[model samples]
Target: MNILHHAVLVKSVNITSVAKLLLDNLLRHVREHVASIGSLSTMTVATLLDPRFKTLGFLSRNKVQEAVRRLKSECTALIASSEASLPHPSDAGESTNNSSELWCLLDETVDQKRQSFNATADAILEVEQYLVEVNLRRHQDPLEYWHKQKHVYPYLYHMSQRFLCSPASSVPCKSVFSKAGRSSANEETAYNHKQ
Candidate 1:
């Protein structure tokens, strides 16, 4: 397929939705890791508390106990919050099965992601503004300007790439080659050769 056609296909796929799907996958991975950590912590605690060897080092025992407590609390909290925030399994499954619907959903997701990106960009800009004002007031050298710019550079680049790939900017892949067929050079050459 041509570049334009490829772009059109990508645009049709609904990137925002794809990003959300990826985010969901990431969350699931994180949840599973948390659960595994919790289980490991519990096993560690059980092993430490076993009375088979009364000669265990005090520091090692204390460390294991502290780690178990912290891991249990943190993992429980993380799992609870993540589970609560996730979409219902049936809903997620349905979404996965419907490709066209997923495209619509993805558009919505992209919109939300864009809003989030904008907010982050604005906050970064505000910080830079604050720094500039402070430096100007204090008559300090603005040598740190580059440092401030660096913080927003990645976001700007991301936004640019996103905009370029968005449906509105995407053109059909066939258009790239189609233009050649419409060139006036061939017509001009034919007329001169006939003359």
Candidate 2:
């Protein structure tokens, strides 16, 4: 995008024509494709989680707000599902005649619930605060950063885990496929020569 902008400022006919065409077509394609990409909640969440290009530095205020809301809701759902999967106190025991023990059990359960609730709220707050910080260095890995900060933002960290494994681009996949093909051909040739 910067290259195109600079090319447009040049006083050369050849560069101007090419840059104009590129800018026009590329802008149109990007606008259309970006809108469709925004529809993918997972991808949007992943983009937001990426510290390098958090919010893509271009998403509108409303769009950013909507994405944050969606991320928080998804994180909340995951938290709820995980907690539901755990054994409940009532399910773990039969009613007993010991009132003091029952009171202790109830108090512990309540404390646990409150702690989880506080943790979730803290995670959301941390995410918002993180958004205000300067972007990560270009060389830094967001996965590593998020992984290290998991304890600080447990829910967001878990939410990021779901989306961060995705390949950032198709170039690496194509490169791997070509490398595999070459290795297979080399192995086949070697086997035929030996046989």
Candidate 3:
């Protein structure tokens, strides 16, 4: 949609005044409706995650930054959630010494915090690298690209599956239903004639 909006939205076009006015009105209405539906975070994230169309559909770098920030936030949340859901190991047999055990707990606390901080940093770097890489070929499938990259970016692969797997709008589904209904009706008419 964003691509289409920018495609013909240039003053360099040589159309007549009346034609240009009609185009301006059409662009205005399309922009208004797209803006209304553009608040969806999923759409933003999906566009960013798509290897073929990453950030190209966005109007500005700030918008790209916003999407990247949102992706990182969700990535962090997913990391934290997975850690919380994991089974905890049973406590070891009673410690032989109290002094070491007291300090070990403190060490574990520090280690865990450091690990969490590092995890977030690593995730941010991953997002940056993904964005920096050139877009995949238009003929390539985003999901397939992600699948091949799963080992390199497991978190993003999981996320891309969640976001990119579904159709963005209902239009495709509606068209499919309409076509199916017409085909079924035609088949019924043919069957009636045969009988």
Among all candidates shown, the one with the greatest lDDT: 3
Model 2 Cα lDDT, one tens digit per residue, 33-143: 555555567766776777776764334677778877877777766776677667655444645569867877887788688757954775577678767777787689888
Q: How far is candidate 2 from the true structure (C-alpha RMSD, Å)?
A: 10.4
lDDT of each: 0.39, 0.66, 0.74
Clashing pairs in 1: 4-172, 4-173, 5-173, 17-106
Q: Give the Cα error of residue 82 in candidate 1, in Å.
A: 25
Instruction: Identify the runs in model 2 with alpha carbons over 4 angstroms from their true place.
Output: 1-18, 86-123, 167-195
Rank by TM-score (best first): 3, 2, 1
Q: Which residues of candidate 1, in runs, are more than 4 Å off?
A: 1-100, 135-195
Which has the better TM-score: candidate 2, or candidate 3?
Answer: 3
TM of each candidate vs. truth: 0.19, 0.59, 0.72
What lDDT score goes with residue 58 in model 3?
66
Task: List model 3 lDDT by residue over 1-195, tens digit each.
Answer: 556666767652899999888778756655565554455688778887889878876656777788889889888777767776766554566565988688678777876796688668877987888888999877788878998999888888889989985444333334444665686699899999999
- Candidate 2 is scored at a TM of 0.59
- Looking at model 3, how many pairs of residues clash? 0
Report the error of model 3 at residue 2, Å: 3.4
- Cα displacement (angstroms), candidate 3, residue 1, comes to 3.7
What's the distance in Å from true for residue 72, model 1? 32
